[model samples]
Target: MKKVLVLAEARDGQLRNVSLEALAAASTLADGGEVTAAVFGSNAAELAATLGQHGASTVYTADHSALAQYTPDAYTQALVQLIELANPDAVVLGHTAIGRDVAPRVAARLGYGLVSDVTSLEAGEVFVRPIYAGKAIQQRKFVDGKTFVTIRPNNIAIGAADASKTATVVPVELEIKDLRSIVKEVVRKTSGKVDLSEAKVIISGGRGVKSAEGFNTLNELADVLGAAVGASRGACDADYCDYSMQIGQTGKVVTPDLYIACGISGAIQHLAGMSSSKVIVAINKDPEAPIFQVADYGIVGDLFEVVPLLTAEFKKVLV
Candidate 1:
């Protein structure tokens, strides 16, 4: 029986979907042993019931003013204390921005083997992860001490919520004394918009978008589908979109359920970030565009016309 500890992720005073997904993964890895979830943030204790419904048997919360915003040094310190107290066999986290930063620090401090961006788990020990910008997958196993892993969101199916289930919530008190960095304020680019990494559907544009005004059509389609908007590096470089919206080797990685590439030529760098999407749709006038190779569905046309048609159709269906 494996004892697993999952680090629950939350943002804007609400739990992130990947946090529950990580809990589900932890439950599977536990294999009938025990699954504990650790949440850190201001008022994070309120999320205990939700975590329990997903699969956590016990929830540890570190709620303090210092933890309200994410800072690498502070988060790592909190996790280090939790790990020392629980002494779990394995520690799991979602491969989000915070997890990517803090997981490595905790692993190094605790002398644990770290596996980042794992996509699959087999027989509780073997883990599968992508290599070389998702060109290949490699399966790895930790031969020794505690295993620390960060799972990619959307790859693993989330467990069903059982409202009848409940977890024992434990409040952990830690003396977080860090003198290095702190987030005094957060400036958001697309505030209140769907997080690109966690969105189920996404609509992205590329250099073919021509200008910033071209993104309006994609945004309309995204609004109809309740999807996030993204852009290729070429689009950002061309000043057609913001760099925060860039999706590629140099930008954010995404794995939405339905990824619509509008006017994107599908450069290798662009594909490296979103190829893991479950279903890809490419819309471009160039029939020989590289994105069509990986797309489940392809449309050879101008996105300015294609996108409005898609948006109208989706609005009708959604309404």
Candidate 2:
């Protein structure tokens, strides 16, 4: 039987949600095969147990000080060794920052095929992914010996957990080599309600918002709905908001449950980021705004008047 491997990511003993989703995908792929997960951290055993609940049968742990920091070389070496030992038919990973860096190198090292940012996976290893910045969808077939795939966050629903199951932990033997790049310092913004990519719901603004103060209205709505804030490329380019908040082809791609676009004339680039959302609501005074074409719900009215009303109504209902 072919074996499926899931690369798990952990931070301070807490497992990343994407890892569980990958496990779920692995479980589906492991119908007649074995499913396993691998992690590199101190408490990887506990993380392996959690991964088992999602369907991993075995877990490989590689704990070391060099593995603590996310250096591409260290992670690639660890995963390369694990893959060499396990020799799984397929390896599943989250299309996250770390995975994006390491997955390709691992594939190249093993002379394996890779499909990145996959939104859907099939039993036969057929995959679906976005192209041209989500403007078009592409279905791809993997006709190779071994395959590596990365799952886009929020695109796949996480399966129910089975806590009764536990994965066998296998420790990996690795020798760290001095790499070219070193992480000097890690700095994070202290003020933020949620990470845009991880947010379940998001409220985004655009050039029509007029000024930086326009984000205030969107924030009110986001607070009422407990959603993260987003901005369009136009707003970011105009210096109305930071580049981090921009959602477009060149920016972050998000697949939240609910996406609300305010004062935004949806361009194709902007739609690429949030178009995969389950529910899309657009508020624009222009009836012909491209946003309406994709929005499940559209309100043709000034955002200044419409957003406050929606915020008030949401606060009243939820509170």
Candidate 3:
């Protein structure tokens, strides 16, 4: 039985969905062993009950004002100390921004093999991840003493919560010092309605979205579907949208349940980030657009006309 430790991530005083997804992945990796979840931040102890329902037998929380915001040095120090205390056989984290930054540092410090952006787990320590802009998949295994992995959100199913179950909460105190940088404040462009990475449905636009005004249509469609809005690199480069909404190899990776591509030419870079979505729908005037190759449903038409129709239809159905 392998003991697994999951780093449960929280943001804006709430737990991120990817953090629970990581716990689910940890449960799978544990294979009947104990699963412990560790959350770090001020007042993070309040999250223990939610973590327990998801399958964690033990929830460790570190509440400190110094740990309120994420700083690479402070987080790395806290995680390293937690790992030493738990001495888990495997450490799991989400492939989100913080995980991508801190997982590598932890692995390097412990001299353990690290695998990032894993989409699936096979028997043993083997993991599956994308390569070459998601054109192919590669299988990897960790033969070291301890294993560290970062799971991509939406790829792993979140376990059903059992309200009857409760976890043992352990509060820990850590000495955080020598912080080179601090996040005094976070400025957000979006209204903080939904996090793009964790959104179940996403509507994306590309260079074909001619101007900033064009995004309003996509946003309308997204609002109807309760989806997050995203753009391809081309759209960002064209100044039609902000880089925060960019989804591609050079930007945030996502795997939503439903992905709608409006006027996107489906560049390899863009596809790399969202090809893992469960259902892909592409709407473009060009029939030969590369997006159609991977789309579960394809519509060859002008997005200007098609998007509004889709939005209206979804509103009727959803309302």
Candidate of highest TM-score: 1
The lDDT per prediction is 0.91, 0.87, 0.91
Pairs that clash in candidate 3: none
- TM-scores, one per candidate: 0.98, 0.93, 0.97
Whichever of 1 and 3 has more TM-score, that candidate is 1
lDDT of 3 by residue, 1-319 (tens): 8899999988878888888888888988899999999998776788999999999999989987778888899999999999999999999999988999999999999987799999989888679999888888999987668888999988888899999999999999888888899889978887465689999999999988899999999999888888899999999999998899999899889999999999999888898889989999999999999999999999999999999999888888997
Query: Candidate 3: TM-score?
Result: 0.97
What is the Cα-based lDDT of residue 256 in candidate 2? Answer: 93
lDDT of 2 by residue, 62-139 (tens): 988788778998898888889889989999999888889999999999988898998887767678998987778898
Q: Which ten residues in a row have the lowest lDDT in candidate 1?
A: 188-197
CA displacement after TM-score superposition, residue 208 of candidate 2 (Å): 2.3
Each candidate: RMSD: 1.0, 1.9, 1.1
Q: Arrange candidates by TM-score, highest first: which order?
A: 1, 3, 2
